[model samples]
Target: MYTKKSTLALILTACLLALLLVAGCAQNNPAGNEAGRPEKQGAVTVTDFIGRQVAVPDNVERIGCLYAFSGHVVAMLGRGGDIVAVVEGLKRDVIMGELCPGIGEALVPASSGAVNVEELLNARPDLVFIRSETAANEGEKAKLEKTGIPYLVVDYRNMKEQMYIVEMIGQAVGEKERALKYNEYYQRCIDRVQERVQNIPLDERVRIYHSINEATRTDARDTLPADWTQVVGAINVSVNEELKFLEDKYFAGLEQILLWDPEVIIVNEAGVADYIMTNTQWSSLSAVKNNKVYQMPIGISRWGHPGSLETPLAILWTAKTLYPDLFSDIDLVAETKYFYREIFNYPISDQLVAQVLSGKGMRAPKGKAN
Candidate 1:
């Protein structure tokens, strides 16, 4: 039975069988990730605004959240207890009181060293998260790295960028699944907004004048450039003309704004109402004469949080304010309640819900808090 040809065929058959067995094991174990597959089993990697690749953690332990809304996103990931800090817990005492209740007793430092960076160092956080693009500058990046910490930044300058940031945040915090859920919800809001604002014919869409007052009346940059202007279906009321007012500065004056002469005026929760109602120059604008003025809600009015779940709500509300008839069927209050419940997992009482949505006692500008 020891024929040379027969022995060669036997060895070939054994090799083929071994190869199939190895393939079976690989399929079952998924030992290596292929391209387009999320690494570490559903853990996706994202490139942050500053251009760095980072893995989105599934179990964020100790976290340093730079903004209140980013903390809310972490809560969505089922890890609020992990967030050890926030940026001043929102300057408006009333909203913070309702939101965190007794929690503000916990110190919120403006900088990493405010209470002492030692606490953060000792905590050995699995990750640290911050909102707003400014946090990701070279200085801060170097600081984080030197301290053996990982940091990512969110840029909410535009609606699309804002949504991307939220998804990125979700993934980074080990809430990829939850992040996906939020994305679906955010897209739904966009769809609803489109349906509502579509009634305004392209050419007929009203022009808007958007501003933020921070102890002084001013023009908000991204309000006109990105979210309200450049969003896919949004129409711009003003163009970015070369002006001294539009730089990195967050606030500007009525004179410059009047020159823009938007058909509609969107006031951020700064000292805008007082200035517009008082300043004769502002009153002269067509928006004031025609009652086409609307107030942008508090929280990220000065600067939106690109990735947090709340950003889309702000957009949807703005779109509704702009086009009520088209969005008549959508109930913002109910939707907001659902949003808070699902994202924060804290059942916000009807009274609190009313307060969050109401414009009563809104904080006048004392400098840009967002």
Candidate 2:
């Protein structure tokens, strides 16, 4: 019923709309998200330790990250909005939602050791990321293979290795150029830390006892290389000469720690430091006698892979605490702020930074965690 003029006008409008749609499609390349970097397509073909060829994805819509640390890396790589599930729930669940509000779902399993195969299968992740050190166990590997999910095991990032993992993961997920930029920037942090510590002799270096929830009442002897000790330059007291039982990888005795007698004791509970400082039995140890014991910040305290990123701060603090005269230039607070803003893309104010690095643990800003 349209007039001839109305019909001709409608046809012209439809042609213009088609051209606009084509233009938008042409411009639609997946650029970087709000997190660290985007995953990139790379020339290198990587085969995981498990013998599976790394499968490249066209679009990674869903991801099942297997460790809290891996989850943190995923969050960092700009997938903060799309992670379908994380291992053992959200990595630092208290901080997860608040830290990255865009993510809508978190499917955590009842247990943490093994990747809950059933839950992951249901989540239908297009890709899976597990820190090789934490998640490359036989059971988990078998489950991933049987389920036909492509997974990669990333190494724990220290000052030096952080760039490698960032780029490697970025490439795997299709964010190549951004990962390289991130890699270079991270390398600078490593170089700066190394420059500060390289001059200190091994003997003069602070003997750090990175404690993992060891108390008199609790029968726990969490050892070194397992804790933040995984980071390069972190002295592994658990594997040192005194703790013969640590060699067994099964059981140990208190005599091991007492014998090693580190220069500093890092405690899971801040109270442990207070007790060690005040305890009658602790008077003999070099760390306690000299008042060298201290508390750990977030990732370093956790001694897990996600916490691996905190190695820089841990090193800075240990150096200052151990040889303040030598490490006068090192500033842990500024370094922490840099990592939050530059690497993780979290905008932490100076006040929030103070709360995060306080000797005591602080909850997220929300009274009831979102």
Candidate 3:
């Protein structure tokens, strides 16, 4: 019993048994790790548009949209019901209100570049989304960072960025597949327009004047409207490098607009087309004289705006409007219905479709004084 070789063999057997027992315990463990200890689990890191790597919960439920654009994106991702806090405009948007009911009850804890930390915390959002402008503000960034909650900054100045933002949001919110589907559709739309208008000479392209909410407020060189108008095979009269005298970099004087003498004028807001057509001040413009003034359609959001997810529809609509013969086979109404049905998962009625296409009764009603 005291023999040295026998004792050494007995020790080796005990060590082998111990190793086997540990492995069996590990196999039974759900983590299936060698240590037999539960693995730490919680968050998944996602990179924002601004390059901030934020650790978002793997399963996000309560979302805080500090920017209206992200709110719309979240809604489009089919997570609209999960939004707990929103920027002011989301509650006020008519289409958003209709599409995402109970959005009105969401808390408005931020405005512009300002965040009320206490209120935002009170909402208990699992994640937050803000525009890059807000993140650029040092004070706002500091406040958001101090909250100890994950936040993602979203920004897009061009069409490419716009598509990327959708993907980023989709990933953050567990809707990557849905986001890929939307981006695919967006690319197809772009390709369709390019294929249709490839042969049209630059000189033959229509000269268009696009007025934003106000009649004088127009897009500039680096804006989305400027980018999309060119893509649609039209000249944006307001994007000239020579016109460096833009007031606030957006407003153009009546004299400047008249100088452009645009062939077609499209206003983004409701009732502006009528004003441009009737006003004596604008009566001498070529578009006004030719009865070519029109209003941009208002869908879930105003299609002409930079923040809109429906920019593809805007591009298609504008291209068709300018070159009807080229896009004559495209049924915009059918496309509109499809967009709502597939993307929003909401079926829009013929009446609502008529209202959106006509650009009437789309604006949110103003609130009364408290």
- Highest lDDT: which candidate? 3
Task: Report the candidate with higher TM-score, 2 versus 3.
Answer: 3
Cα lDDT tens digits for candidate 2, 1-370:
4688888998999999999998666543222121432244533455543345675565766777665655666666667666776754454444456565744456664254567777776666667777564354777667778866667776632334555666666776666666665666555645655666666667755555655445332112342234334322445565434332342233334566677687666665556777777877767888888777776565323322134445555555555655677667768788778766776677777876775566455433344444
Selected candidate, larger TM-score, 1 vs 3? 3
Write the residue-wise lDDT of candidate 1 on 1-370 in tens digits: 5698899999999999999998777654522332333225544577886667876545455577665556656666566555655666443434334444433444464453232344445434556666444454556556566755566765555656655766777778766677777778877877767665666678767566555444233334454244544442445433454334544454444466677677776665545666676677778888778777766554322322222346567667766676676667778788878876785566777876665565445443455333
**The 10-residue segment with the lowest total lDDT in model 2:** 216-225
Q: Clash pairs of candidate 3? A: none
- Model 1 CA deviation exceeding 4 Å by range: 1-46, 55-58, 67-69, 89-119, 131-139, 215-225, 229-234, 245-247, 250-253, 299-309, 361-370
Return model 1's CA RMSD, one decimal.
16.3
Candidate 1 vs candidate 3: the lDDT winner is 3
Candidate 3 residue-wise lDDT, 1-370, digit = tens: 5699888998999999999999777545532332432122666777888888877777887899998889888988889888889988788766678667768788889876688987887677778999877888898888888977789998887888888889989998999899988888888888899898878998899999988888888888876778888888998998863554453347788899888899999987898998898899999998998899989889877887877888888988999999999999988898888887788777789888888888877767778100
Q: Pick the candidate with the highest TM-score.
A: 3
TM-score versus the correct structure, for each prediction = 0.71, 0.71, 0.86
Model 3 per-residue lDDT at 258: 83
Clashes of 2: 11
